[model samples]
Target: MTEIRWLEAFVAVAEELHFGRAALRLHTSQSPLSQTIRKLENDLGTRLFERNTRSVALTSAGHALLPRAYRVLQDMRLAREAALAEVEGVRGKILIGFSGAVNHLTLPPLTRAVRRRHPDIELDLTSRVRTRDGLASVANGTLDLAFVGVAESPDPSVVARLVAREEIGAVLPLDHPLAREKSIPLQSLAGDDFISPPTDGSSSMTEVLLASCMAAGFRPRIVQELSDPYMVLTFVAAGVGVTLMSSGISSIIPSGATYVPLDAPHHYMNHAIAWSADNDSAVLKAVLDVVEEVFPPVAS
Candidate 1:
C-alpha cells in the first residue's frame, strides 16, 4: 500500500528535480529517498522519474502525479491539524445556558472572552433558563455549561464555580415607610407583605429571600409569587409588596420602587458557572479557562 513518506519523497524529488537536493530538503540521505521513490514507483507500476549521473527529470507519469501527490500531503497536514485542534479544545460547538441578571452581568464577558480566545469554537447560547433548569440541562448533557444564580449547585452531578456574589437588598415602593432608610434590617420588613418569585428545588432568589428572612427570625409573608422578576419589581412599585433581591439586579427597579441594601452581616446571592462533572469536553474546558481569567472565584 502507498504510504505518506513515499508521497513526500516523490513530491520533494519531483519539485527539486535532483535526488541529492531533495534529500537535503527532506533531511534524509539520498539513498533512502531514492529507495522510497522506487518503492512508490513499483507500487504504482510506473516510472515517476528518469535520472542519469548528470541530470534528473520527471517522467510523463511523474508530471501527471505531482499535483495529486502534493494534494495528498497538504490534505494529510490539514487532517492532523484538525485533529489536534479538537484535542486542544480550540474547536467544537458548545451549548451554554444563562438566566436572570447573570445573563447581563456575567455571561457577556465570558462569552466575549471565549469568542476572542477560541474563535473556531462555536457558542450556542440559550437564555432565560432558571438555575434549576440550567443545572438539569447541564447534568443531562443538554447544556455544556450554564451561568446561574446559586451559591453552589444543588445537583450532585454538576460542579459550580462561583463567579460573582452580590449583596442581598430589598426593593420596596418608593413611598413605603422603610424605603426612607438608606439600608434596612432584614427583620424590619417581616411585618410587611412581600412579593417574590416562586421557589424551585434549586438555589434561587426566592430561596435566598426565605433564608435571609428566616435568618433574621421572621417568615416573609409572600402575598404573590411571580415568574418575571421585572413584574415582581413592578408589583413592588405598585405598592403590592416588598421583595428581596440581589443588588446586581437593582438597576431594574421600577420608578416607583426603591432599593435599599440589607444592613450588616450582609447576605449575598451568588452567580456561578456550572457544568456536569461527567462532561470532560475540551471545548467546555477552554471556555472555563476563559471564565477563570475573566472572573476569578472570590471568597464567599
Candidate 2:
C-alpha cells in the first residue's frame, strides 16, 4: 500500500517542479526524496517525473495524478482539522497563497482579522511573485485560499471574487524628469525601459501594463523582471527602469523611489480572493467569509 508520506512527497515535488525546493518543503534531502519518487513510480508502474541535470518536469502520468493526489491529501488534512474543530470550535491550519503586491492593502487587514477572530486557526502564509502561480496553487489544493489580481473573466475551476479595485500608478526615481509632474502621460514613458514583475502573461500586472502601454501607442521596453514587488523598486531607484504598480502598493517604495499617478483615469486593477470551487474545508469557508465581510463587493 502506498503511504500518505509518499503522496505528500509526490505532491510537493509536482507543485515545486524542482527536487531541491521540493526537498526543502518536505524537510528532507534530495537523495531520499528521489528514492521516494522512484519507489512510488515502481509501485504505480509509471514514471511521475522527467528529471535531468538542470530541469524537472511532470510527466503526463504525474499531471494526471497531481490534482487527485492533492485532493486526497487535502481531504485527509481537513479530516484532521474537522476532528480538532469538534473539540476547539475553529482550530486548524489553513495555507493561504498571495503575491508580494498584496502586502500593503489586502494582506495586512485580512491576516489581522483572522488572528483576532480565529486565534486557534493556524495560518501558513506563502507569498509568491505572480498571481497566476498563487491561483494555480489554490486550484490544486496546495493553498486553501489565495489573494490575487484578476480580470473580469474567471477560471472555470476557480471561484474568484473581486474584493477591491486599486488605482494603478507608475513607480519612478525621485530625480526623474516625470517625477515632478502631477500626472504623467503613459505615452511619455514610451522610450523608458520598464522593470516589470515576472509573469506568465495570464492576467498579471506586467501583462496589464503591457496592454495599457500598447493602448497608449507603444510597447514598453522591459529591461528587468523582478520576482519581488518590493525589490522591483531597487532597479527603479537606481534609474534603471520604471514599473507600474497599484496605488495601494506604495507602502514599499524605497527612499529614492516615488509613485507618480498615471494619466489613465479609468485604469484600475481588480484584487480578488480565489479558491478552488470544490473546496469543502470548513476552515477555508470561514476565511472566505471573513474576507467578504471585510471588503466591499465589486461594482457592476
TM-score to native of every candidate shown: 0.66, 0.92
Q: What is the C-alpha lDDT of each candidate?
A: 0.81, 0.83
Local accuracy of candidate 1 as per-residue lDDT tens digits, 1-300: 259989888888886799999999889998998899999999999999899999999999999987677556545544554687856736877889876543577888888888898898888887667788888777756678988776445568798888888899999899999888888888899899999887664537788889899999999998998776778888999999999888877776779998999889788888888898767666777888888899976786
Task: List ranges where model 2 is wrong by over 4 Å.
Answer: 52-54, 152-155
User: Worst 10-residue stretch by lDDT in candidate 2?
Assistant: 147-156
Task: Judge candidate 2 at residue 46 and give its lDDT.
Answer: 100
* Deviation from native of the Cα of residue 85 in model 1, angstroms: 3.8
Task: Assess candidate 2 and give its TM-score to the true structure.
Answer: 0.92
